[model samples]
Target: KQAMDFYDRALKLASTIPELQFPLMTYLGKGNALVRVGRVDEAKRVLDEALAVAEGDSAYGYEAELLLQLGLIADQQKDTARALALLARATNLAQKAGGNRIVAEIALETGRIQRQASRPSEAESTLRAGIDVARHMAERLLLPRLLGDLADLQVSNSRYAEARALLEEASDLLEGLLTNASSPWVRSRIIDSMDGIFLARVRLEGAQGQNASRLFAVLEQARGRAMSELVSARDSSNPAELRAGERKIAALQLKLLRTTDRSARQRLLDEIFRAEEELAPAATESFIRTRASRRKPVTLPELQRQLRADEVFLEFALAEPHSYALIATNHSARIHRLAGRADIRKTITA
Candidate 1:
């Protein structure tokens, strides 16, 4: 491939470029390109060099990314055990580095590998964790694929209703993304796959004596949207930007908690609130700059109104000394104190 050739040429000259920054990235790119072209041996050597460079750096995200690439190469070579081990290490490093997107991707791949290894339960658990991380991080690009994979797993398990929900959500998210900057044929391919899920949903809803026509109508409408929008609206604030805001808020909150002076605490609280407000929007406008004045914290009534009649929303907040779970139903609200990190993990695993 031309791309691979380009990378190969570039890599050959990279060692002579003394001014090159992040040489690890150059090796990483070249290794990935080599892997794509089936130059497995060369890719392994280059990737190993990248990994060595990454190991010497304080940034674990680079190390994690390199590990993931190496794991993929191993997977392609039919080295399942080694692939899984590499991916597991990548996942751990990604979590430590706050690389949520990479964590989701590795988890999704790990799930697929487990499924291939005939560990269905582990696959399901891993996929669910990936889906959760993707959703929480607003990772639209990874979320649809992760959801689709999980839905496929659900289909295999004969959990049709759950699968239907997952597919519909995935379709919706994919459709929204496609509308922004993608070819109509992309949506066409997505719809072709989703039509099967729609048919299954119709059958299930019919069996339950519920109206299924509305579902079909919604799907059709989504599919019928104009192919060309003639304009552009893009969200520049990606997960990384939101993450930056989150970190700032968290640091200020911690400082506020530890400060004994009322004025200092108030200032820290104000900064935290401002950061939170900037990230509060469920839907962001790409045309305009995001500002703290553009959003506000959701009030109890607003949150209550947002919940469906049969649905309960549980929001977790990890704070000093204790963690809290705020549970909200249609008309009631309550807070539950989490036992501890270990207990929470055990409860989640159970």
Candidate 2:
């Protein structure tokens, strides 16, 4: 609020002094403030006015900034199409103005928007190109952010190993940047990236069953750290920082809960339920029938062979069966041994 008030006063003074530069800058600043406060409509109006002035005076920087601000506002509203269009224009203007940093940032943001809209292939290419540009320009801040976004897309597409590598690099870069600064925002971002890496590792471990206990332990520790960070942010005066921390905390909590129980049987059941939910009512009957037939019981030897080959496939079998049969494969005819079967006995006077 105070910042906005000062910008408003400065705008008035700039008008009085008839300084074209200050008024344009002040209007852009005020528009950004309005957007931050969730007043998107008002922000658009203010930015449009700034754009008109910039166009009239041929102020390229101010025009590009206004376009970027409007793009951010559109992104906040989930209007990806408009956001991409505005950002494209801003990137072109920034390129023409030799603002490489702004161009890199806009490209990174556009890729993120594409990723959010489920365009992973496009997001991957766009973000990689942006990262290259950022790296060439030595845009350290934008580089790590773009890398993290790309890593997230990789994870979403089941490229776990690639995601892990990307996340590790992002975490390392973020940590190095944090070491020289006392910026809470930067530290929070680094922690968020580290948490993501740990969560991905946990998912991988859970699937493999190689270190389930260790994975859960790491998840619990990360959840605790995220919650503590949220508490610290809540104690701060910055609402935006607090909100970001709170969101991270919520996401960590939900993801931890979901990944902690990775039993194969449970996962299979969940998958079945999900499929049923997604299918139409008329189609569900056939789907269920097909699923049941697909889940037919296998013999003990077959089950053992499957479990030995792939642990992930173990959840599809019945935990307990009505009978147990031991078959010796070395015998000429495969002798079968059955246990727990009692024959009926009768005692008669004869």
Candidate 3:
């Protein structure tokens, strides 16, 4: 909100200045700020205006970024087709502009949407391509999430060993992260990776009778605090700290866009990183608190204990080309292999 306020005030002043006309950049900044505050509708309107202004201008990276942001909004609204279209174009633009990070991110989203839409083949190919780009860029931060996402697909396909390998890689990447100055978003992804690792371990053990005791120990170490402590921890930041950090980040980003000097741009980037680092621990704590406030996740033992005398549970794990199910009755459990999703759907229909 403070960041939005700053941009709002700046635009009001900049609008009146004859020598400092930057309507497109200003609108984009404010739109981004609005997005941070969850004012998606308003952001769409402003970003649309920015898009109109960007056309016929040489804003290569900016144009791609705007499309990506708009695509995210569309995704949030569940407009799958529109989001995919926007993201596809954004991916092309980002790739052409050498924005590998953005390209990887866009690809990840594209693959995710494809998977959601039941286009597993396309999702697998897209995810592989994105992982390749991320590797080329050495995009350590996003790579773990990408790997985890792909591992999930692999799990569903019953590629248990492959999925476990990917999960281990992702978990390793996450383990290397410095938690002290990490964003809530990053921490959330880390937690998600941990979940993926656990799931893959279960699937592997079920399928191959491999003891995952070492893996579980490693996971426990990776997840520093106990789950109970994590659940009980309060938000670490006051409103003032959040507001100040957000404002500084926004200010630095806005300055980065306006400045043409290489040294100045570098300085602005550094400042933005610093600001984000300062906000990371607080954001992470808040996210954990909020997540814990919701329903606690069911443990493997808890799930097993929930089965009734007459009931059986079949936990299906699906990947691109194969599927596996862990079938459990009250007394016994076994792993069964099945054909891919299409075959399963056909069988169910029949």
Off by over 4 Å in 3: 1-5, 14-41, 179-350
Question: Which segments of model 1 are wrong by more than 4 Å?
Answer: 1-19, 182-350
| Tens digits of per-residue lDDT for model 3, 38-111 | 88889999888777656556565667888988898898789999999998888877877889998888888888
Clashing pairs in 3: 156-317, 156-318, 156-319, 157-318, 157-319, 157-322
Q: After superposition, how far is residue 24 of candidate 3 from its true place, in Å?
A: 8.0
In terms of TM-score, which candidate is strongest?
3
TM-score of 2: 0.55
TM-scores across all candidates? 0.53, 0.55, 0.56
Off by over 4 Å in 2: 1-5, 18-25, 36-38, 182-350
lDDT of 3 at 208: 55
Q: lDDT for every model?
A: 0.69, 0.62, 0.71
Candidate 3's displacement at residue 41, Å, is 4.1
Summarize candidate 1's per-residue lDDT along 1-350 as a digit string, tens digits. 77767766776776578686556666777887787777889989988877887787666898899899899899999999999999999999999999999999999889989888988898999999998999999987678777877876776677778977887888788666654534434545655545544444333332333332333343334333321121222334456766677678788888888899999988887887778788766224322232211222245566578889999876553422244555668787655655555677768899
The order by descending lDDT is 3, 1, 2
Please give the range of 10 consecutive residues that has the lowest summed lDDT in model 3: 211-220
Ranking by TM-score: 3, 2, 1
